[model samples]
Target chain A: MDFSSKLLENAVYEMSQLPGIGKRTALRLVLHLLKQPEDQTSRLALALENLRKEIKFCENCHNISDVALCEICSNPRRDKSMVCVVEDIRDVMAIENTSQYKGLYHVLGGKISPMEGVGPQDLTIASLVKKVKLGEIKELIFALSSTMEGDTTNFYIYKQLEGVPVKTSTIARGIAVGDELEYADEVTLGRSILNRIPFENSLKAN
Target chain B: MDFSSKLLENAVYEMSQLPGIGKRTALRLVLHLLKQPEDQTSRLALALENLRKEIKFCENCHNISDVALCEICSNPRRDKSMVCVVEDIRDVMAIENTSQYKGLYHVLGGKISPMEGVGPQDLTIASLVKKVKLGEIKELIFALSSTMEGDTTNFYIYKQLEGVPVKTSTIARGIAVGDELEYADEVTLGRSILNRIPFENSLKAN
Candidate 1:
């Protein structure tokens, strides 16, 4: 689209670089910002700059943090022996929202996706393997998505823990609590049936 | 939603303030930015800040521009006697895209909407009237949306140009070109029927 001002064009170009934002959407957003108070634009810019410049990732879990260790990893009440391994910070946030998992998290940053040219070396796989080899973690929970990349990453990590005595497990693949069985995908339904738990254990909750 | 990092929370909150963006979308955008290289965020922030800090609006037409006078208003080739009055810069851009209009433009900044606490005094109506009173303009085209607020604004401006020796007309309201007659709204179809033009005039080309 032709913009009247170079500044507006530049701003729209930068905004359109964001994921899921197209040229028209970027123009709309830039125009909205132009209509708002100048201070609002300044605040948004400052927040984004500061977030990128000053934000830190936890040394242990690789999750976003204000310090060396993220809140979950630093908390003494969390079960250090039970670590949930996930792809990125969004997964950590999702699990935290559920409030069911009280263990620490190990954010791999991303899955091993060959299509995207992202290998295990590109993620935090080495650090996670080293952590497991240290013998502090007794149970490593694989909480990545049920995709080829997720499975490959999990299997690679499992193989790395060769002689380690830690028990490895994946999150359950089952129909949602309120969802009808007929609506469930065949693969997930089959897996849920094959790995069915005891009738009495199904009723247990934290 | 709870964010583990205060920086992330601040960025997400600021991003969600944009029109049509929600908390979930804001978080997704922020996470995508985090995944990208740091320079991308810095460039986005700098561009937004610079756009707000250094951007200029045309003094005559109130359209966004790099100089005191907008390109359209300063161009000698444009029909200075005919002016299309629009609500905002977006309308100006939309009209420019169509390439059918060869006249100058007057950006009103916004429509007069009492419900939104925006009055005629809040817009650039006074300057527009002043420009018309200068006696250089011979025709004024009202190209605002066919809404209550747009009509009120057009009428208010029309009253301001009383006895100014300028011909006034609104953009035609009818079934859109290449659109089905059955799909046209009742108000538009009714008006199209009542204001039917000469049969031969409908066949005229640009």
Candidate 2:
């Protein structure tokens, strides 16, 4: 769309470059900033700039962090020998929120998606393999999603750790908790039945 | 939600301040930016800062502009005697895209909405009335939205222009173009019938 000011146009263009934001939405957002105090925009800009320039990643897990080692990786209480592998930091956050597991996480950055030109080399697979080879981790849990890309990345890593004297396992896949059985997808329902655990074990989980 | 890095949290917080953006969406957008090249975030931050710091408003119509006088106002071909009063620059751009009107625009910044603590004094209505009182404009067209706040703002401006030598009018309310009459709302359909123009006049509009 035509804009009256070059400054406004430039701002809208840059905003629309973000994922999921279109031109009209970007214009609306920029106009909103104009209506707010000038300090708001300054703070937003400063925060983004500082995050990009100074943000760090955990040396052990490759998770986003403010220091060399993220809080989860550095915490002594967390089970360092039991590392859960995930696609990104968001998954790490999700598991952390549940408070169900006390293990450390190893962020893969992303899964192996050949369609997007992402391979095993594009992620932190090498570092994880090195950690396992060094005999630091006793067990590795594949907590990636159940998608094709996720399965591919998990298998790739599993192959890398062949005969490394480390136990390997995957997260369970079944109908979500609190979901109606009638509405569950066929594959998930079938898997839930096939992988059904003992009633006492399920009771103990809760 | 918890963030691994303080910088990431601050950026997400500022991003979520934009209208319609929630915490989860803000996190997704921030993470997307992190995955992209560093220059992308820097460009977005710089553009927003420059726009907020260097933006200008037209001295004549109060529309966002890069100069003292907007292009539309400074154009010799535009009819200065006929002004279409609108809520903001977005409306100005929309009307300009129609190419059906060649008159100048008077942007009021926003409508009078007491619910939002917005008053007529907060807008550019006084300058428009002063312009009408100075005999610079012969016709004043109220093109604001049909909401309660829009009508209140229109009536307030009309009252301020009382006893002035200007003719006041408002944009017509009717069913949108290409909309089926069977699906038209009762109020719009009734108003369209009551305010029907001659067939020849309708033909002339096209």
Candidate 3:
């Protein structure tokens, strides 16, 4: 689209570089910012710049943090012996929101994806393996997504922990709560049946 | 949702303020930026801040510009005697994209909406009238949207130009190209019928 001002064009171009935003949406967003108060625009700019400049990662888990160790890694109440491994910070947030798990997390930053040129070395997999080799973690939960990349990363890490003495497991797969079983995918449905929980254990949750 | 870093939370909050963006999408965008190179984040922030701080408005038309008078308004090839009045810069860009209009523009910034507490006084109506009184423009095209607010803004501006020597007209409304008559809304269909053009004139185009 033709823009009357170069500044407007530049701003829209930069905004459209974001993951999901397109040119038209970027223009709309930039125009909205133009209509807003200067203070709002300045605040947005400042927040983004400061976030990029000052943001930190947990030295232990590689999740985004404001200090050397993230809150979860620093918390004494969280179970250090039971580490739930995830692909990124979003997974960490999602698992934390469930409020059912009191274990600590080891964020891998991303899963192994050969198509994207991301592999074990590109992520925090080595650090996680070293942490496991320290012999403190008693159990390692593979909480990555059920995609091929997730499975590949989980298997890679599992292979690295072959003789590390930590019991390993994956998160349960089943029909989501409030979802009809008929609508569930075949693989998930099949897995759910094969790994069916005991009746008394299911009744104990709710 | 909780964020491990205060800076990340602030950036997400500011990003979610844009139209159509929500907390989840905001988090995704912020995290995506965090994963990108530092220069990418800095460029986006700098572009937005600079656009807001250094943008200019055309003195003649109130459209966004990088100069005192916008390119279209300052162009010698444009018809200074014919002005297309619009609600905002987006309309100007849309019309420009059609490559059909050769007239100057007068951007009102917004249509008058009483429900939203927007009045004629809040827009660029006064400066537009002043321009009309200068006797340079011989025709005024009301190219605002076909809404109640658009009509109110047009009529209000029309009243302001009472006894002025310029001819006034609104853009024609009709069923869009490739749209079936049966599916067309009643108001637009009825207006299209009543304002039907000569068959020869329609055949002359395309």
Q: Give the per-residue lDDT digits (tens) of candidate 3, residues A1-206.
A: 88989999999999999989999899989989988999999999999999999989999888899999999989989988988888778777766765657788998888899999997889999899999999999888776766678768878998888877887776565657544322345566445534544322433443
What is the clash tally of candidate 2? 0
Could you give the CAPRI-style class of model 3? high
Error of 1 at B10 (Å): 0.9
Q: TM-score of chain A for each candidate?
A: 0.84, 0.98, 0.84
Cα deviation of B7 in candidate 3 (Å)? 1.0
Candidates 1 and 2 compared: the better one by TM-score is 2
DockQ sort, best first: 3, 1, 2
- Evaluation by TM-score, superior candidate among 1 and 3: 3
Residue B176 lDDT in model 2? 65
TM-score of the second chain, cand. 3: 0.97
Query: Which of the two candidates, 2 or 3, achieves a greater lDDT against the reference?
Result: 2
lDDT of 1 by residue, B90-128 (tens): 899899999989999999989999899999889999999
| Residue A96 miss distance in model 1 (angstroms) | 1.1
Model with the higher lDDT, candidate 1 or 2: 2
**Residue range B92-187, candidate 2, lDDT tens digits:** 876676566778999998989999999989999889988889998988877776667876897898889778888776655575654433344545
Model 2: per-residue Cα lDDT at residue A63:
97
